[model samples]
Target: MSDGEELTLADEIVARARIHAREVIDESELAVDLGALEWDVSARARRRAGLCRWHADREVATIVLARRAYERYDWPDFAGIVRHELVHAWEFQQFGESGHGDRFRERAAALEAPRYCEAFARPRYVLRCLAADCDWRAKRHRASKPVKSPDQYRCGGCGGSYEVEHVASGRTWTTASGYGGAKSALGEEW
Candidate 1:
């Protein structure tokens, strides 16, 4: 095949995989009904691909696919990786943190996407971080460590602030801010 033709086919494969990922997420009914989510595809050379983020206030989520991984793996496996990441987004919305703890694992298993932590041992790309209101721009880099606690950043537009902290170990999330709306960024209404 011509180089151009091969590249086009590779691109198509990745595109199809991303669509499958979204389909799986939609079918799970686990993700928040944020109307529509965004998808991005790029090569590993570009550095900032194969990541996903969810913006709570905006009710939007974005997925980034690494171009290299897309070209190397089959569509089903690639889609599986995407679905795995989407689970983090769902967990973040329901709880917080894209951790691989019991709750995250349980939810992922419920969606038929079990944890493949060992897969990360290889030099393969990752679909990382599924949190709302996080602007973790894509880069061709792997996090040296998993995120321990969710971040707390302020919004430039609305001046609203939110913090994502882990509930106790083995505990699920509930909409309770110890100090009421005044102390919680999500507010009492949440």
Candidate 2:
């Protein structure tokens, strides 16, 4: 697509959200109502596709999209996430509250938004079952507590210990060696 023909994700969100907002609550100045709607990208969000937060003090709503989710999903699929967050914004504007309750679900249905986003799949870590006989393993996209401290966890299949490895670097850490040159979780020094 040409640069002129392209809209950044943030711009696309505002344009689509403006139209969707009007549909949810009727107002000629709903444009202005949604002018307070802000868009941001979140690098730390692991599981959720998007978040809608209302700032009571500022009387504004900010929608944050997960950077990994957007990178993995096509625009069409990601549009559903935008719609879901918009439903939250609409609910707050009209009902003074927003959540996964009856009203939110009804509004979400009318907007064709999904109830929940799919799991993030860009795996950065690999968890391997250390039982010599057990071949079970998992690919993880986030460095969650369990993934970071595999020693604290046991494999479900063999009840064996685990080894965590960085996918790209092939750096492996096990209970015996302690990860990151330290003798345990975090590091040997810490």
Candidate 3:
């Protein structure tokens, strides 16, 4: 596309991103809203397709991707891309760079989004049983807490020795850990 055409498309993308930023700010119920900040977002032909925040005088702004990245990546929708950037906008409004802490993780999770608002595919982790015959597979954003240590395993058909792995606070450990599990083994087959 010509320079003028690119500029127009970039403007449109920024406008939509700003709107979504407002929505995220409202939904977060953060101390400061996106409207309260004096920021502007525009698209640029960057190597990577993503959003970034620019802070100015206590206010934060964002710039999303332009046609280059999207065109290269075959992005289908603009709204989703904008929404992801808007999340960063909301983060800036809330905690000013530190907003990406546990609270942010919680809010993002609560959003029930398969991918970021920006439409970038979320990270995926594949879990497979170590056993050769076991074809059990699981996909998750984060790994589940381990109820048992790596030394533990259970047989579904025949009762085998297995320890439960408890995953909490983003840490995984076996029930045998000091976190209290001995008394909790009610019907444990192991």
Best by TM-score: 2
Give model 2's TM-score versus the native structure: 0.54
Q: Write the per-residue lDDT of candidate 1 for residues 1-190, one digit (tens) a residue.
A: 5666555644675567556766776777676544455666754433332565777777566666666666556655666667676776666566545677887788778767647522321332222233465543221133222211213323333334333222222221212332233234444432
- The 10-residue segment with the lowest total lDDT in model 2: 23-32
User: Which 10-residue span in candidate 1 carries the lowest summed lDDT?
Assistant: 139-148
- Summarize candidate 2's per-residue lDDT along 1-190 as a digit string, tens digits: 5667877665655566456556545622222256778878777788778889888778788888887787788866777787788777766666667898887677677667787667666567788998889998887876677676778888877988888887766677775345545324434323
Model 3 agreement with the true structure over 1-190: per-residue lDDT tens digits: 4666555555755565567666655665534455554434334434335655657574765555556545544433554454455556566766566345576566555553214433233423333354565655433443344333323444343333333322222232333452244324422521
Each model's lDDT comes to 0.51, 0.71, 0.47
Model 3 residue-pair collision total: 13
> What number of backbone clashes does candidate 2 have, counting pairs of residues 3 or more apart or in separate chains?
2
Better TM-score candidate (1, 3): 1
- State model 2's lDDT: 0.71
Instruction: Give me the displacement of residue 49 in model 2, in angstroms.
Output: 4.4
Error of 3 at 89 (Å): 1.8
Q: Clashes in model 1: which pairs?
A: 42-67, 47-139, 47-140, 48-138, 48-139, 48-140, 54-132, 55-133
Off by over 4 Å in 1: 1-15, 25-27, 32-36, 45-49, 117-190
